[model samples]
Target chain A: MNIILFEEKEISSTYHIQITDHRAKHIVKVLRSQVGDRVRVGVIDGGRGMAKIVAIKPKFPFSVDLDIQLETTLPEEKPVIDLVLALPRPIMLRRILSQVTSLGVGRIFLIDSQRVEKSFWQASLLQNEQYREHLLIGLEQAVATRLPEVSIYPKFKGFMDELLVKDLDDYSALIVADPAGTNTFSEALRQAGGSLRQGGRVLLCVGPEGGWVPAEVDQFSGCGFSICTIGERILKVDTAVIALHSRIMALREIL
Target chain B: MNIILFEEKEISSTYHIQITDHRAKHIVKVLRSQVGDRVRVGVIDGGRGMAKIVAIKPKFPFSVDLDIQLETTLPEEKPVIDLVLALPRPIMLRRILSQVTSLGVGRIFLIDSQRVEKSFWQASLLQNEQYREHLLIGLEQAVATRLPEVSIYPKFKGFMDELLVKDLDDYSALIVADPAGTNTFSEALRQAGGSLRQGGRVLLCVGPEGGWVPAEVDQFSGCGFSICTIGERILKVDTAVIALHSRIMALREIL
Candidate 1:
């Protein structure tokens, strides 16, 4: 873990907090931190700064006490991209959640597609906010505090017809990834008149393993979503997400 | 699997081949191919075309007979990029092999580094060409035939002082990834006067999980390797590989 993250409720006082969970074990066993040593720490959806280790048990049920000091500077830049993904298998979903979170996203929409297997929707990872742990793991990896909101839509029509229509104005551009797409991502952004630096938000839609059916592609096209291709090579769902996100982030940096 | 791959030695006569391996099982079970059905097929380091299923035994110990027809057209374009990676953990190495292969790389050099665990050098994945299976899986996913060459270097200095010096003239640019890098990837590329479309080969070097030590970074700098960063986020080793590769490929498309 790059940073130790704690929820707002975990703070016991103004400047002192004790952690006895995995973070404590990580600090003791992995980091091998000693008393008086300062380590990076962040409050979820809050500030980031250093925490001075005050006490350490370094034994079973390991615990660590820290004196927190958060920087008053501006918060980290919010992510400009959002994702609309067809629910993958539970195993892949778990990995994608952590990886994408590390890459940074404003929000995630796990929606249904015709090619998505019905059994995937029944996975426990999507139940009772079980997915939040994966997101938290991502935040730790990225050394950031903001947790991206995740919403699930089990019905493809509902997601496309209702939610998308309501959220259309929020994004400067809507993009759907397709292997057969004629336009590259940059070309699609140019064609749509979207500029990332101009406070424009991008909503990228990635389909299931089998890819979007022709009718589904037509639906996306009807909604002003530009079809874009990364390349001719077909990647797995998790790899595609990371690759696309990386490309977008790079374009943002260069453009 | 998007395409079934066959070794050159597996071809019988001139245009016929029989398969009773995992590929056959995938055809019978996952693809559910029937007699006379044509499926995409490719010969390793060879041409890609269609294979008509002539006969099939769908039961356990499944087998299939195919009549192969390779197109006379030229083979797929070779990858212009190569990778110099610090050995990661075994599981992550497996994923990286397949993911990087799918993304397209001409060669892979897995070398030791200061932060790389010593045990990683002994992984079976690095021995007996056992890693070829992951590469083939990647080829199947990408529907391409050319297999990238992989080499292992257990000693960091040997790789740097010997192999890299011999291969220095082959690449137009050499890049080393560092989180503290002052230049973005595109800036480094421009500084190196490298253009991907001009048949320029780029060699990308990625460090291990804990990152390269100062001495290693100095070694890279001494070799005319431009230091570049993807962004501020600290991604896992596997995620970083995919992200960096994706950014390079995207830049190739746009530039």
Candidate 2:
């Protein structure tokens, strides 16, 4: 983990906090931290800072208690990108959750689609605590404090017709990924008027393994979502998420 | 699999070929192909075409014999990007091989670096046939025929001092990824005089987990490698590779 993260409930006082979970064990065993060592630490959905190790007590099997002093607040930035993904297989969803969160997406909407397997909606990975766990893993890896909001939409039409239509104005642009799209992502951005770098929010929609159905594509187009392709290559969902996100982030910098 | 891949030796005659391997079983069971069914197929390091299932013999427990006609050819494209990566773990390497290959890299140099684990060089995953298996998987996924070349560099200094110095002129730009780099990738491309989109080859070097040491960074700088950062977030090696490749491909289209 790049930074040690603890929830608000874990803190006993303003400056002193006692950690007894896996994070404490990781600090003592994996990091080999000493009494006086200062390690990077962050509060869940709060701020990041250094934690000075004050006490290391090996009290239970496979566990330890660490007393640390929270030092300062980290410089934080607001998240600009949001993801609208068709629910993938449970295994791939878990990986995507961690990876995309680390890449700094502000929100995620795992919605159902014609190509998504019905069984995927029943997966326990979509549970609140489970999703939060994966998000925390990502936050720790990226050394970020803000937790991105994640929502599940088991019904496709309701999500698109009701929820999305209401929230469309929140984003500066809405883009959908399609292999046969005539516009490259760069051209899509240009057609949208300009880059998303000017503090504007973006909502990027990626399809399932089989890709968006013709009806779904038409629905997206009708809702004013620009269709763009990463290129000719058919990328797996996880890979495509990173590719599309990276491409946007890249263009936001130079365009 | 997007396209059924076969080694060059598997093509028996000018118009037809027979099969009785797992690929054949996959065609019969997973794909549910019968006589006269057409499946996309490609010859390794050759051309992509359609293979018609002329006959299906299910006499063996887990095998099927298929007679086919090779028809048509895929449009061939030249590779433009080359990768220089510090070898990741075996599991990650397997994914990297397929993923990077599908992204259309020309050559891959799995080189040792200061932060790279020595044991990584000893991984059986680096074995010729094993590596080729992953590459084939990538080609099958992307429906591409030509395979990218992979090379191993067990010794860091020697590869940098001997091979790299001698072959520096082959690529138009040499870029290295560093977290502390002042320039974003776009700025680096601008510094290199323009876009790599005009058929110019690019060599992208990504550091190991902990990143390149000062000495290694200095050596790269001495050899005219422009240093660029993806951003503030620390990305895992696999994520970084896709992100970097995606960024380059995106810029190639716009700039």
Candidate 3:
């Protein structure tokens, strides 16, 4: 973990925190931190700064006392990109969540598609808030504090219908990834006259392993989502998401 | 696997081939091909075409027979990007191999670095060409016929000295990835005047997890390598590789 993250409730009124969870274990073992040593730290959905290790109990049930110094102002969380992904297999879903969170996506919509196996929706990763661990892992990797929000939609048609009724004007462009796309990502962005730099968001839709069925593709197209390709190669869903997000972030000058 | 791959020796004089290995199993179980059905197929380091299923013995030790029709001309392997990576842990190494191959790299040089653990050099994945399986997996995913070549260097200084002796005139730009880089990737590309569109090769050097030592970074700088960053986020090595490769490919207009 690049940064040690703490929830708001963890910090005492005196700006002192005692961590005994995995974070404390990580600080003790992986970081090898000692008293008076300052480590990079951030508050969840809050500011980032450094924390001085005040005390260390290296015995069983390791604990660490930290004196926090958060930035006066919170970092603005204006993530310009969002994802509408067809739910992948559980293992892959975990990886994608962590990877994309590190890439700084604002929100994630795990929607259903024809090619997505029905069993994937039953995965424990999607139940309760089990997926939050992966998201936190991403946050820690990136050394950022903002946690991206995730929503689930088990019906493709239902999600599409909801999109029709929602306010999508905040999005400057809606892109759907497909191998058979007529235009490349840049071409599609130029054609759409996307204002990505002017505080506008882009919604990227990715398909399942076998890809979106014809009707699904048409649904996205009907919703004015530009169908685009990253290249000729058919990338795995995880690879595709990272590549697409990287390219988009590059275009936005964020990466 | 998106496309089935075969070796050159597998095809008979009559252009017929029989498979009894994992490919045959995939055909029978995963692909579920029937007699007279055609499947996309490619020859490793050769051509890509379709194969017509002639017969199938779906019993124990399942096998399949196919009549092959490959393209007469060989597809040119003109990969423009190469990687100089500090050896990562074995599990991440396997994923990187497959991921980078799918993204289309020319050559991979796994070298030693100050932060790289010494044991990574002895991984079984690097011995006897066992890493080929991961590369094949990548090629299969992309439906490509070419395989990337991999080299290993157990010594960092030795590898740097070797680079000095070898001719690197073919490379238009030599990049070294660093979080403390003075330029973003695109700015560096513009500064270097890289001839990516003219088929000039780009060599990207990535550091180990904890990053290159000052001397190592200086050595790369002395060798005319531009130190550049993908973004502010400190991504995991595997995520960084995929992200950096994706950005470079996008910049080259190849993706």
Best lDDT goes to which candidate? 1
DockQ head-to-head 1 vs 3, winner: 1
**Predicted model 3 interface RMSD:** 2.1
Error of 3 at A196 (Å): 1.6
In order, candidate lDDTs are 0.88, 0.80, 0.86
lDDT tens digits, residue span A1-255, model 2: 899998877777656777777887788777888777888888877777777877776545434334545555543676778999999998988888888888999889989999999999888888655878888888888888888888788888978876565788887778899886666777667655453656777889999997999899889888888888767777788889988998888876666
Worst 10 contiguous positions by lDDT, candidate 3 chain B: B188-197
DockQ (0 to 1) for model 1: 0.83
| Residue-level lDDT for B125 in candidate 2 | 86
Show the colliding residue pairs in model 1: none
Worst 10 residues of 2 chain B by lDDT: B66-75
- lDDT (Cα, tens digit) per residue for candidate 3, span A141-216: 9988899989899999888888788846668888899886776777766554547656678899999998888899
How badly does each model clash, as a count of residue pairs?
0, 0, 1
> Per-residue lDDT tens digits of candidate 2, residues B3-122?
888877877766567777878877877788878888988877777778888778755554544444455454357578899999898899999889888888888998999889888878
Model 1, range B115-153, lDDT digits (tens) per residue? 999988889888899999999999999988889999888
Fnat of model 2, as a fraction: 0.71
